[model samples]
Target: MTLFEAERVEKVFPGVRALDGVNLSLEPGSVHALLGENGAGKSTLIKVITGLYRPDGGRLLLDGQQVSFGSPHESASAGIGVVHQERNLIPGFTVGENILLQQLPTSRGLVDRTAIRSEAARWLAELDLELDPDLPVTELSVAQAQLVEIAKALSIESRVLLLDEPTASITPSEAERLFRVVGKLKDQGCAVLFVSHKLEEVFEICDTVTVLRDGASVLEGGPLSDLTRDEVVDLMVGRVHEALVLPPRTVDTTAEPLLELSGLSTATGHDGVDLAVRPGEIVGLYGLVGAGRSELAKALLGLDRITAGEVRVRGAAVRIRNVRDALKNHKIGYVSENRKEEGVFLEQSVGRNIAVTVWDRLRAGIGRLPVLRYVPKRAEADLVSDYVEHLGIRIASPAQLAGTLSGGNQQKVSLAKWLAAQTEILIIDEPTVGIDVRTKDAFHTLIWDLAANGLAILLITSDLPEMITLADRVVVMRDHRVRGEVVNSRDYDTMSQRVIRLIHAEPAPAA
Candidate 1:
């Protein structure tokens, strides 16, 4: 039986028709996939269904009865729960409080703490999470927070659940745990709408898929067995898709290292780590969750304290005080993995986001006054336009807010700032976590081109295929320490085997 349905939904924002005649249906006891490129109206449709936005045309139905939700709370009350890609948990709130925030139990007009803890614990155990109910949300890791959000959604006892990019930040094992929870939900007659750019995961668990293209449904409710990956790609892109083929480029191994970490130790538990990235080289850091790949990058950028180590740049030892010093003094730039937070400023204009790194250079002041310095609008505009055109960022206008643009475009804006800063060495963490295949290909090509132009890049990602596609050498990390390094042959079978072996290998004994 159909648990929920959207009939020819339409949503318009100003001049842009965000969604046009889109349709979706969720049947009980099945995982239905919602697939699309970034900005293809998937998020918009989700918002319309969850009551963050109301459809301008058509209507929604719950159990064949027409229904409209004025807000997310109303939707949740009606047994519809949604976990958006961006987390909504409040900082400093306990796990139990966050989970039951929608319907907190009260005693004599005061919040019932005991009831909240027990109720939240019951929901958390449903997903096999061993979390303390009183633990603050801020204390959780990214993956933990993601799972907690799902537990919060499930606490509403939703008959219909919408999960957006749930596995984007999680490790493979964590993802499998989520898949198991999804299996249990389906067995319990729950209808699930799963949204993700990871096609393999979608194919593994989804029964039916709906593909969106430019605010319209190109394919709706098609069985996964009936479609090939290529076919789905075509539906999402509206074209006969071609795989990205990068040109052969050679890196000079004899060249001096642009960035070198010798016996680096960080406060975040990294010990005796040694790594190097020479000019025009792409060195990948590949590992499982909690492997300290991103932590190492943070320490390099001075976000985290480096306890003991020698960081040499171009054969000279230097200490980076912060991201600013790394960018301006050392010509090093880092594109953070948490793009929504540390990357592009969502509320700012695209032009400003791209020009942020070069503001110091673009600024002009009165003849002898540094305090009165201001960025020349003309200069900023020119630079922003240059990178926008070069990076092929699709935006209605430069003034469009970064939040309004799609994930892929926002990422381009994030990387554009680094390039604009003329950074010789770049560290990109999980560059294509939740982006579509076509956009991922474009980004890979861009990275390849940058390296070809003599830019040194330190790439961090858990996607082995992505690592093989781009990195010339792969550095394996385990427990915040370097285990081994693999030279990329670009052959998935051989490279993946070596990487996996290194990941599961026993630790070396101390002398």
Candidate 2:
């Protein structure tokens, strides 16, 4: 039976027709996969279906009866739940409070704390998540917080569940757990709408597939078994996406290393780390969560204090006291994994954010005069305009807020900021997280382009395929230390096995 349907939906923004006559159907007991490129109108269609934006035309039908949702609350009340890509939780609230925010148990006109804890625990247990109900939301990791969002959605007991990029930030093991829960929900005849850029995940869990392109439904309601991955890609992109083949490195390894860490120790637990990136080289740091990949990146950027070891930039030892020092003194920059938190200033204009790193250069002044040191707005805009076009960033205008752009475009802006900084050594952590496949391809190309132009890159990622695809040398980290390094031959199986063995091997006994 058709549990829900969007009939001839049309939605438009100021200058863009986000959705044009898009149609979708959700059947009970099936997971429907929505596949598209970054700007293919997938998000807009979801928004229309969930009542975040009422369709400018057509209507939504629930159980064969046409209905309209004025707001998200109305949609939720009508058995629709959404786990958005960006986390939606109150950090000040405890896990229990976040899980049952709408309908908390009450006692004598007051909140029932014990009942709330018990109820929240029950829901979390359903998803096999082991979390303290009393812990503040801020204390949870990105993956854990995503699980809490799922638990919160499940608490609604919605017949129609919408999961957007659910596995983007999670580990393979954690993703398997989520799939098991999704299977359970399918068994219970829930209508699940799954949106993801991970084609493997879609093929693994979804029963039906729908492809959207150019704000229109290009393909609809086909059994997953009937379509090939190549077919889906072609449909979404309107052309065959040639497999990305990274060109041979032009790096001169004998040259002085642009950035090197010798006997590095950080307060966050990484110790005795030894790594180096020469000009035009790409070094991959591959590890699982808690293996200290991000912590090491932080230490490199001086976000964390380094107690031991020496950091050398361009053959000269230096102390990176903070991010400013790393950028200004050492000519090094970092692209944070947590884009929303540390990468982009969401409330600021894209031009402003991109030009921020080059403000000193943009200043038209002599020394020591505050008024004379003012930023030249025209020069900054010209610089930003070039990058916006160079990076293919899709923004209505440079004045548009960074937050208003799509995930892929926002990531491009983040990259643009570092590019504007003109830092010779760049540390990029999880650069493709939450982005689409096409955008990932673009980013990979850009990274290679940067390296080909003699900019050294240090890439930290949990994704094995990405590590193998881009890195010249993969540094395996386990238990907060470098276990070994493998040369990438572009052979996925061999490289992955070697890396996996290093990741799981027991640490050597202290010498």
Candidate 3:
């Protein structure tokens, strides 16, 4: 039975028609995957469904009865719940309080903490999670926080759940657990809508798929077996995708290794691993969620603890215990995978954000010597402007707030910050995620130019095409270890297949 349906949904923003005549339908007990490129109208549709935006012209039906939602609370009360891509939990609040917020049990008009804690604990226990109900939300890891987000939505007894990029930051084991929970939800007759750019997860869990492109429905189908992955790619971009050309390898460069990790490991997420990158080479690290890709990157950048290994730069081992150490010693730059969290200060002006990274370069005699705090100057603004122009970032002016730019443009800003630093080894994680096709192409071309300038790059991504296109060699990781290595040659496609197999292959028994 059809649980919910939208007809002729249309939404328009300045300079962009976010959605046009987009239709969506979900049935009870079904898991529907919504697939689209970034800016392809997936978020817009979700916003419309959850009352974040009103459709200019459309009809929404619940159980064949037309319904209207005026606000998120109204949608929630009507059995709709959304787990936003960005976890919106308040840091100071306890998990239990966040779960039962605004509707806590009351005793004589006083809040009932005992009841709320007990209820929240019970729900969390169902997921086999060990989070303390009384602990502040800030105490949780990203994965734990994600679980709490789901628990909060589940606490509402919602009939329809919308999960946006749910597994983007989760561990592999956690993602499996989430899949089980989604299955359980379906078994209980709940309609679950999953929106993600990860196609592997979509195929693993979704019952049906709805593809949207350029704010219109391009295809609707059940059982995605009929569509090849390339077909889906073509549909999203409206053209045959051409693979990126990586420059040929040269072994004679005496430029030395810009960055080196000798059995570097983060105690929290990844174990001991070794990596090295040379100037003018792009090293691809490919893995599924929780395979330690991002964690390893963090360790190299000093955002995470090294725990038990040494990081070397220019043939000398350096102790970088923090971001400042990494920055000053190695002159490294990082574009994080979770761009919304660690990428940019959205409320700040683009000029400020870009100039902030290279303030020292433009400052006169340091106001504070050791501390390295300096005010921005005209030279800093000019440097930022050069980067903005080079990256082809689409914004009215550098004075605009970073938050107002589109996802792709925001990504460009994130990359521009690193370029301004003039770092030797640039580490980027999932750089093109949540970006459209045209913007993705532009971003790739810019990165290619950066590599051509003799910058060693470590690119971490789940996008297979990107790995094949951008990397001179690909390293496949599984179960927290490197499984196989592939050298990109004329046989790059065949080698990429081996890399994929290595990524998904089961681990062998420890010797």
Candidate 4:
């Protein structure tokens, strides 16, 4: 019997039918893969399953019995746990507190701190995670935070578990740990619904798959052994998601560097980080999860203290006080890898997120009172619509909440905000972490076009394939220091081998 099932489920939003007769079944003691491209109703289906949104039609069966959930808490109480693609941890709370937030222990009507720590620690140890229970959620790295969320779900002791892009921010080594946890969960007869864009991982761990395209199921609960990767891809995107298209463009090596880092030592342990990006150049910062690539970017933006060395912008030594100073004064913008937290405002409307950077320019001043200015609604909508069209962001309206969009669409909006700023220098970290194959390709092309148009780009990505496709030069960083640089040949095997050698302390060919 199916542990849980979405039978002919349909969900509708304003001007969009997010789910149309979508069918999925999760079986006890099996890992089921839910496959779909971005904006293909994957997140929407998960929302419906977890009761973040109620279905417009169809039945949700738990243990072969029809049931309904009015809220996420209700679903959890009914023995379902979920780790959403977007983060759900609250800042300023300890990891232990966040883990047991839904079912906090009480003694004499007060929260039991000791029970929370012991229970949270048990769940963390179950997954082989070594995080301290007392550590604040704000202090955890992206991967650590992701693991904590997983631990939170596991703490529910639910019969069904849903993980949506759980490994997107984590390294392969960490992902292996998650896979092990999934294996144990399956052994315990917990129905696991795994959703990810990484097809290799899905093929490796999943026994059965359900492929969704355009809000409908093309393949429902089929055995993975019967379907090749190509077949799965075709089902997810209908023959349009494979190619990584990049136009040829030559960078002018003679031009002065727009953004240069000279002997850059930071409080975050980055030392002697020398980098340069000239006009129309894509300089890729390639590294492992904790190699300080994101830290280097943060130091450049003045988020971390620059204890030593200089960050030079266009030949002049400068000290960037904050992101605002970096963008408004120096015409530099950064698209953070943690998009849900730092990229776009979740609760705000899509239009507001896209028009944020140019709000100053969009504002109109009253007669002789330049200081008193407000943004006109018409101008903001037109500006947001242009970006939404250019980026191919699928939204019913600009007024829709950004949190409601899929992960890939949210990522596009993040990049669009920087583009709206018209920054000469851009730092994009993990441009397509949770995005699907086709959307990832389109994003790569977009980044390429930006470089071709004379914008200096500093890209930090753990994705080797993406680095090979987009970066003109790949600078390898290991343990917070530059190991070597490779002039990208765009050859996958060759580039992968060179980067692996550099990461492993082997000498690399000159750029």
Tens-digit lDDT track of model 1 for 1-511: 7899999999998667889999999999999999999989998999999999989998999999999999999999999998888778998799999999999999999999999999999988877778999999976766678888998998887999999988887777778888998899999999999999999999999999999999999998999999999999989998878978899999999999999999999999999999999999999998887788988998998888999989999999999999999998999999988778889999999999999998988999988988999999999999999999999898888898998888888889999999999999999998987798899999999999999999999999877889999999999999999999999999999898888889999554466
lDDT of 1 at 66: 99
Best by TM-score: 1
Residue ranges of candidate 3 with Cα displaced over 4 Å: 56-59, 100-135, 171-173, 219-227, 243-247, 250-255, 261-276, 281-311, 316-329, 359-400, 432-452, 459-511
lDDT of 3: 0.79
Task: Give every collision pair in model 1.
Answer: none
Would you list the C-alpha lDDT of every candidate in the order shown? 0.91, 0.88, 0.79, 0.91
User: Residue by residue across 1-511, what tens digits does model 3's lDDT show?
Assistant: 8999989899987667878998888988989988877667887888888898999988899989998888888889889988877677988899999988746888999989899889999779766777889999876655567788888888888899999877765645567788898899999999999987667787788888888888898987555677766776677778766755545545334657788777666776556677778888889998765577877777776666767878888789887777666666678888887667788889998998887777766667555575665555678778877988888776667787887566677888888887888787889888876565556777788777788888889998767777777887788887677777777663657765677678778454367
Which has the higher lDDT value, candidate number 2 or candidate number 4? 4
Error of 2 at 378 (Å): 2.9
TM-scores for every candidate against the unseen true structure: 0.94, 0.92, 0.76, 0.92
Worst 10 residues of 1 by lDDT: 502-511
Number of the candidate with higher lDDT, 1 or 3:
1
Could you tell me the lDDT of residue 88 within candidate 4? Answer: 92
Alpha-carbon lDDT of model 1: 0.91
